[model samples]
Target: MALDRTKDSGNNSSQATGNWKPIGCEEKRAAVHVEMERVNKLPANSSYATHRLRVLNKVLHLISIQRTASQNEELELLFAGISL
Candidate 1:
């Protein structure tokens, strides 16, 4: 009953066999980390995977916005001479 996550096969098709637990947020994040580590193994022009990454990035951005205030003042002071 023990699963070796370090040696996980990375075959998501196995999920349909009902042998896996429901993935929570932390597990989802870990899965993303594993996939990112193997990015070079992926084929090019995978729109589905690209879309998933974009959605994940947006979710992380929203979470950051929720957790912290904008450092607008510091940014303005640092770029005081730069014209936007």
Candidate 2:
């Protein structure tokens, strides 16, 4: 459920479900390379493709954080029960 009410026609909704991890600093640049792997689709060095990949990478990072926080909470609960 992505709500896109903006002047720009292009609106993308990105979300991840299931286990996730923290995306470190290098993840962003590595994402660029991974995106570049699908080179044939885009004209060589297309700026739009580059920007899209960056945006996707950032969204993934955020989603990873969400999953990580949830996992941490679950782990804390488990540990508390064990110590009890």
Candidate 3:
């Protein structure tokens, strides 16, 4: 049944990834390809990724501020004014 599914997908999709174990050269090549793809797709100080990190940081900072604010109303207002 699963073999039929494999054959069906292979027939349909452009890239067919079935359960196949590579032995020597092919395995090494696949590993290299996967590694290269990961490296290439990884962002290096890009705007969108940085934006996401900044958002996460702001959330954590807000959480910290909220925890530490207490009844210090002036400090709470100051922190709240600095929006992300």
How many pairs of residues collide in model 2?
Answer: 0
Q: Give the Cα-based TM-score of candidate 2 against the true structure.
A: 0.31
Model 3: lDDT to the true structure: 0.45
Specify the highest-lDDT model's number. 2
As a whole number from 0 to 100, the lDDT of residue 46 in candidate 1 is: 80
CA RMSD of each candidate after superposition: 15.9, 16.0, 17.3
Task: Indicate the worst ten consecutive residues by lDDT in candidate 3.
Answer: 75-84
Order of the predicted models by lDDT, top scorer first: 2, 1, 3
TM-score of candidate 1 on Cα atoms, chains taken together: 0.33
lDDT of 2 by residue, 11-82 (tens): 221222323454553554465456546643887588876765555544445435645777655534433332
What 10-residue stretch in candidate 2 is worst by lDDT? 10-19
Which residue pairs in candidate 2 collide?
none
Q: Encode model 1's per-residue lDDT on 1-84: one tens digit a residue.
A: 976555556686466355765444455456545654454355658875665456445443443343334443333332232211
**What TM-score, to 2 decimals, does candidate 3 have?**
0.29
